[model samples]
Target: MNPTDKNAITESVSCPAVFIAAPASGQGKTTITAALARLLRNQGKVVRVFKTGPDYLDPQVLAQASGQPVDQLDLWMAGETYCRRRLFEAARSADVILVEGAMGIFDGEPSSADLAARFGLPMLIVMDVKGMAQTAAALVSGIANFRDDVSVVGLLANACASARHRELIELALPKDVPLLAALPRDSSLALPERHLGLVQASEVQEDLELRFEAGAKALASEALAEALMRLPPVVFEAPFEDPFVELPSMAGITVGVARDPAFSFVYQANLDLLQQMGAELCYFSPIADSCLPECDALWLPGGYPELYASSLAGNRSMKAALLGFFAADKPILAECGGLLYCLETLTDYNDQTHEMLGLLPGEGAMRGRRGCQGMQTADLPEGPVRAHAHHRSISQGTPEPITHGRRQRHPAPGEPIYRARRLTASYLHLFFPNNPTAVARLFSPEPQLQTCDQSDSRSLSDAVE
Candidate 1:
């Protein structure tokens, strides 16, 4: 059945909820949210972890913290109905639903506070009280008063040094507000970092679990657990409708998707939507997998392909298989990290360059290429394209003359601001369901300036790779 039909089968549900927010971005929302989910999961609760914005990395950490794939809840990106559906789905099996907010509570349009107010989830404000004492109360009070809709559950004194520090901050809070938890300024719990926020959980891979365990134990206590229990639930009706932007399904063939630790940043919803639209989905790992599955088209989603440069480079069979697909001229779609792997060479952090599929001209360069974030909408010479950017590697291609991207920054809320080509490669991971029509066209039989060879699957024993 198609996604629309399958979605109709989802039974709506809602349960106890808590929104981890802060006085501001540096107040440790991501850290606290991860720690809380980890602790709650340790308590045998099925924790449904979520983020309140279009963040890819934080959700990865949160998913690890709860031992489940995390989902996003953004009014701007996914809209209210879709967010409601995700919430409903989580409530079905999740014993507790924890949402990590972006930046300050009231920051960003369709802010976390807006989502919280819409869902009725109580907010626990975490403030980095390192810089002030009594003024902390004023800050929390300002957040509380800034919007009457957002409920102030309690304050957690982050970066506290000692009991005296916690006491002073606790006393400073309005007498009505309580100090839920106090985290001593322990440097040991600090997560790794680089140009972009915390090292994307995937970049850390095997070691992330150990770090998550330590952070959870360090942040959680009896008090935090009690405070979580007191958090008000976001009351809502049943059978919550899905909030899909609705893309029309085009007549198309099966499309294989590459998914593994090396290429797993694809939104789960995209896969679901693709299958719903009648295209078959075949998944294979380029790290060790030799043969591509039965597919008409192929999609390589973004991930830390640079980290596994050597392994992907050595995957001779995978390389050969991809080369076969190129021979077939199959419609191929790839994003950021995936885009990197498609190039002739990918440079690692140590400045070592390794050979990759040379179908695309550009090479991934480790040379410091900062200032690459924000949204972009492509007015592709082929058609309209909407995408985002978040990468560090600059292109070192011989003919890297703007194949198809208009650099966009500080794009207004809900604005289509960037465009690219049929073969778009950007750091900004996108959800196809947001634009079903374009998504449908991407995989449909409709021919534009380019077309894929219509062919049947080849045998795996002697597959392309």
Candidate 2:
């Protein structure tokens, strides 16, 4: 049989997996998921955790709790084959696989429910049950019975106060769906947050460690820890061939990636794709390093630029280095916070202004609680790459956009894509694996333009599906 064929006899790997989801956002999903991961890790079990959408902060926290590298799993952004292959590979070595969902269970286009149902992974709904008891059972029952395709194995009632609260929820639950555990309302279990989502793990690792231990002890009680261990192993099939095996090579091209507290939003998968395509990667810090790494191209991903605006402005040598690189016409990709850093001025949340790199004649200002966020396609001159926009800041007085982002659902144009010399700056974060060819060209010295397309994985998707 052809190894790449749909009828190919592929080997299967089995491992226990659970999709940790919630009724809606702000329901303590990350906290409970991290607790469960830490609880299992304390028992010496290798736990592999996957986040269900485009996120940077939660994955950092989850990775620390699980003691494993976390990967994002999205059906629309990453494709079915990519998600499947990641699961299969993790299953081979992982004792338990935990996928933390984004937003509500069935919120997005390819929602958490869609991924869970497709893979036959049962869901453990985490909801805040402080306000009601029997109502909790009602909501969970509706979610479980609403979709026949999805499987609901149990419910993890969060923020339960007294024994009476647990008893009311337990008694109202259907026999088929069990109440796994009732976690107490403890402030210590909560993860700190800011304008974005959770605080970066590196900033408060010690505090997170204390919270993780507290959460683990809570979940370890009432046989909840024992119940999670009993989840049946799910079978996963391996991909026939690696997707990047045939990607265009960028040999001898060294790309500099900004990686520090100020610009740490670079995707692991993006770096992986670059290396797989024969490109060399070097890391440099814009906040700490005075000079750019000796490389052919530069990538500055999004981060909390507003928080470090003063420090970034104080680093005069770094600004000069960046200007020199821009003057040389080297390719520089800046997204969100990176775009802010490139502007002439940036206003922080406190309204404090600081001078920036001035590579672009624009100013960025932080807007409290008001921002744009959605999936879009960067209609780049090189080619189209699937991307997303999530930022609280807005830009002013920049050059006219060379092109606009194609919104995922809306008919209107999304964020503006600005091109100054060889630099490509935008508020949208590009998912490189979606279109390796486009990304390769973006970072190359002379990009050869082509007809715009979503990705180079259509044939792979067809074969896998």
Candidate 3:
């Protein structure tokens, strides 16, 4: 039976939704979305927030602002069915749903505009009009008229120099496209960013709260509030039963998850799916913790391991525990930074080398430019899985490749998945909802050995050295 069609219970719900987008990156989509969410929540409305693409950082800020867990909505990686299911579920309890777009409005293959058009949601384009006035309207007009399916309902002028600046831009905007709000140039309202993008919200919680409060105040004008309240309701039919209900259970399994500053790039939905499948998850820090929690399998997610390489390398007990875990032939799944942690050494962007777990025979070097990126699909024995690969570190070794990935933008080979014994290490971060069975089987108790011809399973000691 089709996974998305099994035991489907149909129901309809109304969710007033809008996609907060921008003309390009750094145009304040995330900031505006957070401000709007805060304003709506202040008005006593339950706001469900979502981020468009495969980002982990922006969602953190959105979640904090809405006081709710933010989910990602992507057309390719997350799939249309999954996106519909999430929208249906959010509509059940949320009075409004705000989706923060990725990059520019029409950036990638599955851009924010595509998502809005797919779901019949209007676009609230936020543009940074720092230098020009009438030219800003040309950009907004181009985005609004670029596609027939999607419509730009409103515009938010960000980083305006003065009241005169805001007035000029408002006058220049097309009559059809309304100017909802003009946020004055306030560096205090800007969120701190790092190489990967905005720094994680946890790192600067107090500062982020202040920025959100200021943003809300700037966006609390009567026009902005009225425009938000007047958004058309999104109506969709979906199965009443949780979509994850059909997934096969993994009873009696405990999955140890690495969760810390060094390994925090995990999707919340991934953990939720694990719980829904009956797997007990225990989180331990490799940077601060000395040992791994007892579990049947281990999952090391992607994060800023490069930034804390020395600390993770200094954690002798944690390194030993990881080596022992690999020796036991227990299942393990590592992505990006996790893959780096399993290597013998990690060279940061500054060219300093630090010892790593050495579970895999390789040394990962952080590069100034992105090593690999874009949507990736891996063909595994279990099944095909779709994910996104965004990293800046290159691993140097000849580990046997278990699955080869294909990139979406270019029809070229992508990241290679390395399998040694029960370990599945790769640069691609798998979206669990895409193929729950394949992911669950990765942690199944009864491990399946690879075919003799394709077998690259090596002894733990041999793999490390």
Top lDDT prediction, candidate number: 2
TM-score, model 1 to reference:
0.81
Task: For residues 1-465, write the lDDT of model 2, one tens digit per residue.
Answer: 134555334788899899999999999999999999999999899999999989989999999999999999888877887788789879989999999999999999989999999888999999999889899999999999999999998999999999989999999998878899988899999999988999999999999999999999988886766887788878887666632345667898999999999998877788888997789999998889999889999999999999999999999999999999999998999999999999999999999999999889999999998799999889888878788889999999999999899998899999999999999999999988887777888999886676645454332233322
Per-residue alpha-carbon lDDT of model 3 for 1-465, expressed as tens digits?
A: 133554445557787888899988999888888988888888889999999999999998999999999999898888776787778778889989988899888889888888989888888899999899989888898888999998899888888788888788888888989888888888888888987888989888999899988888878863586687787787866633433445657888999999988898889988987887789999999999988888999999999999999999899998999899899999999999999999999999789999998888999998876566789876666666678999887889848787678787687788998988888899999888776667777887667533433222111111100
Q: Model 1, stretches more than 4 Å misplaced? A: 1-14, 199-210, 218-220, 238-252, 378-386, 396-424, 445-465
Candidate 1 local lDDT, residue 123: 85
Clashing pairs in 2: none
Error of 3 at 205 (Å): 1.0
* TM-score for candidate 3: 0.92
TM-score of each: 0.81, 0.96, 0.92
Model 1 poorest 10 in a row by lDDT: 456-465
Among the numbered candidates, top TM-score falls to: 2
Order of candidate numbers by lDDT, starting with the best: 2, 3, 1
Lowest lDDT 10-residue stretch of candidate 2 = 456-465
Tens digits of per-residue lDDT, candidate 1, 1-465, equal 133454545534557888889868878787778888888888898998888776677887888778998877776555566676677768777888888898878777668899999988888898888977778878888787788788887898888878888878888788667788888787666677665567778668567777677777876653586567655555544333333533345445787788876687767667766776667777899998988887767788877787789999999999999888766656677777777887889998888999988767767776564746554444433333345667777666434434344434453432112212334444556666555445655555333532332221111111101
Model 2 residue 87 CA deviation (Å) reads 0.5
| Residue 391, model 2, lDDT | 95
